[model samples]
Target: MAVIATLADVRDTDPVDLTPLQSTVDPEELDSLVRVRNGANGDTHVTFTHEGHAITVHSYGMVAITPEHELTAEKYERGEGR
Candidate 1:
């Protein structure tokens, strides 16, 4: 997954690059994880922590990211993270 794409959807500002996620999981791995979760659960979602933010990627092509401080965990878990 492209963190920049997901971040762009959830955040107000546009990120020029994913440099901030350099220490996080590889983008390819993230993409692979989403693919696996989608395949295993048939369009389900999988979430993980990245840079202190909770990131959820759904098989329906929705990516929701909320920081811990925002306390949007319930919304994200309900697939309403947007």
Candidate 2:
């Protein structure tokens, strides 16, 4: 099963800091492949991958390592991730 990890969860588990990766990517590009929401704490964000696309989720954020299988924007809108 695919797992979801929050920023806090990542910090607790991983020893290496991921500030560099977070700074490199555009937040808009990240949003293109996944949905990010402000966590309850308001300091961190929770990222959810596009369904069926098992993305490699790092500590800073989520990335679509593999190309997404053909799916229309309408289909994506029907579901949660867009």
Candidate 3:
């Protein structure tokens, strides 16, 4: 829900316009994994791309979404885009 809402907000479009997060990643598994990591006070993080955006969902309740261009820039900045 959060991921969809965020991606939609960032893209300035309705949630229905975006691909469902379930197609990219298993929500229930992700939640369970993050929940356990959070319970243990660990720094759990997961990153994936959806709808041309790079998304990082942190166990601490932070969701960072980077658009395709920014992601390309970041990868090139680190000399990995090529």
Query: Judged by TM-score, which candidate is best?
Result: 3
Which segments of candidate 2 are over 4 A away from where they belong?
1-5, 13-21, 35-82
Model 1 agreement with the true structure over 1-82: per-residue lDDT tens digits: 3566677656655665444664665666667656644344677666777655788877667778888666677778778887
> Model 2 — which ten-residue stretch has the worst lDDT?
1-10
List clashing residue pairs in candidate 2: none
How well is each residue in 1-82 modelled by candidate 2, as lDDT tens digits?
Answer: 1132333243354423424334444556555444444464233333333333324643334433332443445467788455
Lowest summed lDDT over 10 consecutive residues: which window, candidate 1?
A: 32-41
Residue 16 in candidate 2 has what lDDT? 39
Can you give the TM-score per candidate against the true fold?
A: 0.55, 0.24, 0.82
Measured on C-alpha atoms, candidate 3 has an lDDT of 0.85
Ranking by lDDT: 3, 1, 2
Let me know the TM-score candidate 2 reaches against the reference structure: 0.24
Q: Among these predicted structures, which one has the highest lDDT?
A: 3
For model 3, how does the per-residue alpha-carbon lDDT over 1-82 read when each residue is reduced to its tens digit? 8889988999899999888899999999778756535466877988989999989888888889998888789889999977
Alpha carbon lDDT at 30, candidate 1: 63
